[model samples]
Target: MRFSVFTLFPELLRPFTQEALLGRAAARGLLAFDLIDLREYAGNRWRKVDDAPYGGGAGMVIRVDVAAAALESLEAVPDEVILLTPAGQRFDQKMAEELAQQNHLALLCGRYEGFDARVETLVTREVSLGDFVMMGGEAAAACLLEAVARLRPGVIGDEQSWRADSYSSGLLDYPEYTRPAEWRAQAVPEVLQGGNHAAIERWRRDRALERTLARRPDLLATAGLTPQDSAALLSAGLSAEQLAQVGAPPPPRKSRKKTPAPAVPES
Candidate 1:
């Protein structure tokens, strides 16, 4: 996937992309980045890309003309142009998956108070990291980029790793342990150590359901639960009524095998 980042401070984005998973992906050509300096599009001799809002706001607003010009300079139009701002749709795993399917993306990072309202016209979508405000959108752009890029095929060393990531399956990830089986007097779950593939899978699913139920029951409302999932959650101590509240069907009842009457001493 190709990503074009428009920011006044391209320096902030460079260090992140040059390290970790992103760096490896870029080196492998599985991902690409075009870091455009928004200041280059500034019309003034001073290269000023921001100005005080017309209505007299406290902080300067990124100029629409500069932002639009920077976008137009791209070699090819991106599949999606995203403007980062707090007023936009919330970014999530589903959105990341959707973006990974696109061939190219352009991320416009706003500085100062925000982008000029007209700047919205040039982008295909507006997205926000969360409800809070930040110094600028550069960091958000980096975060958004990493989220989308990792979903691309072969970017992550283990594809199953991403599938197990929190929210990938609409449930928080199950607990994970590594190396030292016993740490500080705490031992890893026996189910994990036992080499029973089926049992281990069951254990992971149950833990994931339980953790999601305890921490973020809200996600369960729309989560796609299989019969196995229902069974797991039910076995994890969630009552049928509680499961119903989250839209999960009741777990299937286990059939009881009646023991035949004991032979009367062969009489």
Candidate 2:
């Protein structure tokens, strides 16, 4: 996939894309990245792209005319342009998977106070990493790039690796331990060490269930539960009320109290 990033700070974004999984993916010809410096499209001798907000505000806002010109000048424009901002729809694994299927995308990053609200008319949609603020949108663009790029075929070198990623099944990933089998008094679960494939798989599934219920029960309702999973979760202390939460809208983030992780098979 091709990603053309519109950012005032390409320096902050360039090194990240050139060195991580994104780098490797590019090396293998599975991904392409184009960093479009917004400053290059600025009209002034100073290459200034922002100004004091209209009607009074704290920081400078990116001027829409300059941004509109930049978008117009793209040699290879994308059909979908995702503008990063706190007000946009929240981004997640599901969104990433959908985006990965697109042949190309344009990620527009905002700086200072943020893009002029009128700039919204120039792109496909807006996306947010989560609920909080950042110094700029470059970091968020990089995150969206990595999330979408790594899902493309041949990017990870192992198809199964990403299939087990957190949220792939609408549940958090199970815990993993490596290197020191015994660390800080915690031993690797015997099921993993016993060389029994069935037992290990069973252990992983149960752990994923227990962990999701404890930390994100809102997910269980749509986790594609099987009869086996229902029976197991019931044994693991999932209640009628919690079960009803299935298919219901997920609770507000950071609002629900955590439930204790119920026990699953350890041996």
Best by lDDT, which number? Answer: 1
Q: Write the per-residue lDDT of candidate 2 for residues 1-267, one digit (tens) a residue.
A: 888889988888889988977898888888888898998888998999999987996989999998898888877778698899999999999999989889989988998899999999998999999999999999899889888888999888897889898898778899998878999999999888888999888789889988998998878877887655665677689765665557433323345788989989889
Q: What would the per-residue lDDT of candidate 1 be over residues 23-87, giving only the tens digit for each residue?
A: 99899999898888999999889999988889675878888889888998998989999999999
Which window of 10 residues has the lowest lDDT sum in candidate 1?
245-254
What lDDT, from 0 to 1, does candidate 1 have? 0.90
For model 2, name the residue pairs that clash. 221-246
lDDT of 2 at 211: 94
Highest TM-score, which number? Answer: 1
* lDDT for predicted candidate 2 compared with the true structure: 0.86
Query: Candidate 1: deviation at residue 7, Å?
Result: 0.5
Q: Clashes in model 1: which pairs?
A: none
Worst 10 residues of 2 by lDDT: 246-255
